[model samples]
Structures are given as structure tokens and as C-alpha cells.
Target: MRFIIQRDHLVQSVQDVMKAVTSRTTIPILTGIKIVATEEGVTLTGSDSDISIESFIPKEEDDKEIVEIKQPGAIVLQARFFSEMVKKLPSDFVEIEVQNHLQTVIRSGNSEFDLIGLDAEEYPQLPQIEEENVFRIPTDLLKAMIRQTSFAVSTSETRPILTGVNWKVENNELYCIATDSHRLALRKAKIEMETPANYNVVIPGKSLNELSKILADNNEQIEIVITENQVLFKAKHLLFFSRLLEGNYPDTSRLIPNESKTEIVLHTKEFLHAIDRASLLAREGKNNVVKFSTIGDGVLEISSNTPEVGKVVEELKGVSVDGEELKISFSAKYMMDALKAIEGNEIKILFTGAMRPFVIYPINDDSTLQLILPVRTY
Candidate 1:
């Protein structure tokens, strides 16, 4: 395989595909990136079984030549070294040639490096996903949905299912939810579709996080195709594929309460800052617990106490608290996370009781909701 490509274009594609390459893979070939040069353009693929990312650079775009292919073939080069070499190449273009026995040479202006390449045939083939069930979503909207929920996924592998975010689509509506048993985040959006079909899929939170990072703030529509065990995300010139978890995600609809005893409307930033300050002291405590009390005269008291570090008390102004006045204790970290995920300036928090899980939502928006389980402070 031989190709001369623009340095900047190759660097961008390499970085995108590198997200799927894992250094800890048991297979030696998995540590390298597969490059294929064809008549159309050059394609770079990186995969680690669970996730695969492919980026394409056309030979000519907008009447400008981006890649010139001398021979049509494929080669796999070590990702770490190749990525660094491409980034530091001191020229506007890079020339790559693969000779007999998979020997590869990368050359720029005044420097050249030889890397032992593997046969691309050894790389595992990406699972083919038939476009039978396909849907489209705006890139920015998809990124928002991922951001609002992926953080709440459990990091522990004990319950493998909980490590992924649950994505459900029904009747032209998309819902994304994630929870670690202590806190839950849910986001809903209306989607445009022709035929309506219900889909319940669990995608690894880590994969979604990577996808969100790769999705730029553009108005382009992304095509999503789901098969029995794989999901494919197709952006302009990039394709991202992830393996679906095997177990059924637990039903979380019943976990959200229907009633509330106390409701408070407060500024998101105010509450977030209060929690941030309270966490300073709570961090010294056992479970990082902070107490929130609803007092008279539109005042919310934020306090935390540690046997060795004493206590802290702060009052946040500008909130309307109704129903029975209550005091509740919860993880400061959880509250801060929920507050950061909210998109509005004003937020409403609904508390069923002192011990029940409380829900947080934007004042006038029902499309997004966050729930946090209270922690007991003796």
C-alpha cells in the first residue's frame, strides 16, 4: 500500500479513530490501526472488539486533492507510534509506503521513519449492521442526550448492565436514562421518523461518552442503525460501532415517584454553588453527606458536619419552598452532578419525604429530570 496524504487531514482522522484503540488488548494486532488506500480515498480503522471507529478521507474534496493513492492495499501500524509521528511530522503532506513483508515507511519533509506493519487481514472484521432499523438525530441533540445521562451510569462492573445507559425510542420519542442506584438522569426528546417502532437498547456509557466527544456542534444529521447485538452511528465521514450489552436493563419507570410533599424552586447556579461549598466539609465526613433544610422566609440552609472536622452552615437566598418544611441528607457529589446536568437557570426540586428519593427538573421543562436517593445521617 502506498499513499501520500495531507498531514492535517491524516492527523484528524487518526485522532478520531484512535479513540477505539485500547492499549491493554490481548491481541497484538488490536494495538495497531488499519489503513486502507483505495481509488476513492484513504480509510483508517481502529477497534478493540467492544468498540470500533472508522474515518475516511476522500481522494479529492471540493476539487482539491487530499490523498493520492499509488497502490491499492492495506496495512496495520502501531497506533501509539503512528499517531505521534503524524502529529510531529514537519510538513504539509505525509507519504506512506508499504513494501514486502509488511514493512512500512512514513516520510515527511526532512524526516523518515520505518515501522513494522502487520497484515490488515489479521484485524477482526467489524460486525456488519444491516440498515433495517435506522433512525436519524441531530448531532448536537445526540450529544446533549449523552451528556445528560452518561455520567450517572455505574462505574462498577459488578452489575454489567448498570454500566451502560438505557436508550428507548417509542412513537417518535427518544428517551435516554442512566442510574447507579443512588442517582438517576433522564432526558427525553421528540424525534422525526417515518415508521414508529419501539427500541430498548443498552449502550455502554463509556462508548456514549466517546461518541459525544467526537460529535461536533454541527447541524448535520447522524444516521443510527441497530442490529441484534450492535449499534452503528454514522456521521459525515466517520462510522462508530459499539457492542450492545446482553442483559435486560432494569425497569426504572416505577422508580420515579408520582407525588411530592415539599417542592422548592431555586436557581440552579445558587444551589450548585451551595452544594460545592458544603462538599468541602462533607469531603472530610464518612460518606460525603450534606444536610439540606427548608426554613422560613425563602431560605435554604446548607450544612455538613464531620466529627473530626467540625461543621459548616450556609444559607442560600432566593427560593420558594412550599409544603411541609423538611430536612434531608444526601451525597453532596450526587446533588452537584444533578445540578450541573440541568440546562435551565431556575430548577424545581420535588421531595416526597425526608427519606424518599427527590426529583429535580427545570422549572418549566419536563423533558429532563434527575433523581437522587437521600442518605441517612444519624
Candidate 2:
């Protein structure tokens, strides 16, 4: 393959595709990126069995030439070295050529480097997913959904299913839920489709996190196609594929309480800051637990005490506090994480009891909910 391409465009594409390349792959070729030059454009692909990303640079866009192809060919180069070299190339354009025996030449400005390339034919083929069950979502919204929910996925491998985000689509609405048994995040958005579609799938949190970083924040619709075992996300000039986690995701609907014994409305920032300060001392404790209590009308006290460390006590006046008097203890880290993920100035928290899991969300928004299982400290 031989091509002279805009360095900036190539650098961006290489960085995006490298997210899927892993050095620990059992297949040796998986560690390198496959580069293919065609009359239409140049395509770069990287994969590590679980996830695959492909980036395409068109020969011409909007009547402007982005790539000048001298000869159409394909080769695979070490992903880590190639990506690093492209970023440091000191020129506006980069020229790449492939010669006999898979030898590759890279040049820009006054610098030139020769690299041994692997045959593209040895790379594993990405699954060709039929767009039979396809849906569309705006890129920006998809990124927001992933950011809001993926953080709560379990990091433990004891329950492999909890390490992923559970996605469900029904009644023209898409829902994403993640939980690590101690805390849960749920987000929902409405979607439009030509035909009625329903699905329940578990996608690895790591994959969603990587895909979010590659997507640009825009209103452009991203096409998604899901098969029994694989899911494909198609963006402008980019394609991402991930293998779905095998096994059924546990049913999380029943975990959310339908009623509450105590409810409080408070400013999100104020509550978040109070917890942050209290955690300063709580972090020294065994469980990093903070205590919350409703002292009087619309008055709440947050306190943390570690025998070895000093105690911290802060008072926060809520917008509204009603229902029975309550005192609950929970992990300061969990509360802070939930508060940051929720979007709104004012938040409403519903507590069923001192020991039951409590739900937090925006005051007027029902689309997003965060639940934390309170620590059993009275």
C-alpha cells in the first residue's frame, strides 16, 4: 500500500483504533493494526478478540483531497509503535509505502523509518453483522448514557455478569442499568424506529467506556446493529464491534423500591460537598461510612468519626424534608459517585428505612435514578 495522507487525520484515527489493540492477545497478529489502502480511501483496523474498531479515511471529502493513493495494497504494522510514530511525525503529511516481503516505509518531512509488516491475510476477520435488528441513537446522547451508567458496574469478577451494563429496549425507550450490588445507576431515553423492536443485552463496561471516548459530541445519529452474540456501532467513517457477555443479566427491576418511608429534597451540589468533607475523616475508617440524620424541620446533619482520625460534622438545610425521622449510614464514596452521575441542581432522595436501599434522582426527572444500599450502622 502506498499513500500520502494528512498527518492530523491519520493521528486521530490511529489513536481511536488503538483502544481495541491489546498486547496480551493469544493471536500474535492481533497486536498489530491492519492498514488497507483502496481507490476509495484508507482503512485502519485493530482488535483483541473481544472488541474491534475500524477507522476509514476517505480519499476526498467535501471536494477536498484527504488522501492521495499511489498504489492500492494492505499490510499490518505494530500498533503501539505505529501510533506513537504517527503522533510525533514532524510534517503536515505522511507518506507510507509497502514493498516486497511485507517491508513498509514511513516518511514525513526529513524523517524516514522502515518497519517490518505482517500479512493482513493472517488477521482475524471481524464478524459481519446483518443489520436485521438495527436502531439509531444520537452520538452525544449515547455518550452521556454510557458515562452516567458504566461507572456503577461491578469491578469484582465473582459475578461476571455484573461487570457489564444491562441494556434493554422496549416501548420505544432504551434503558441502561449498572450495579455492583452496593450501588446502582439507571438511565432511560426515548428512541424512534421504523419497526417495533425489543432487546435485552449485556455489554461490557470496558467496551462502552472505550467507545464513548472515540465518539464525537454531536447530534449525528449512530447506527447500532445487535445480533445474538455481537453488537455493532456505526459512526461516521468508524465502525465498532463488541462481543456481548454470555449469560443472563440479573433482573434489577425488583430492587428499586415503589414507596418510601423518608424523603428529602436538597441541592445536589450542597449535598455532594457536605459528603465530600465528611468523607475526609470517613476514609480513615474501615468502611468509609458517613452518617446522615434528620435532626429537625428541614435540617440534616452529616457526620463521620474514625477513632484514629478526627471527626467531621456538617449541617445542611434541605429544600424539603418529610416523613418519619431517620438516621442512616452509607459509604461516602458511593454517595459521592451517585451524586456526580446525577444531573440536576436539586435532587430528591427516597429512603424506605434505615437499612433498606435508598434511591436518589433529579427532583423532577424520572429518567435517571441512583440507588445505594445503606451500610448497616445505626
Q: Which candidate number has the best lDDT?
A: 2
Q: Which ten residues in a row have the lowest lDDT in candidate 2?
A: 190-199
Candidate 1 per-residue lDDT, tens place, 1-378, comes to 899999999999999999999999999999999999999999999999999999999999999999999999999999999999999999999999999999999999999999999989989998887777678899999998998999999999999999999999998889999999999999999876656778999999999998888777997899888777889999988999999998999999998999999989999998898899889988977689999997788888999988788888999875688888889999999999899999999999999988899999998999999999999773
Clashing pairs in 1: none
Once all C-alphas are superposed, what RMSD does model 1 give against the true structure? 1.0
Measured on C-alpha atoms, candidate 2 has an lDDT of 0.95
Per-residue lDDT tens digits of candidate 2, residues 178-241? Answer: 9999999999998867677999999999999999999999999999888899999999999999
Error of 1 at 116 (Å): 1.0
lDDT against the true structure, per candidate, is 0.92, 0.95
Name the lDDT value of residue 285 in candidate 2: 80
TM-score on alpha carbons, each prediction? 0.98, 0.99
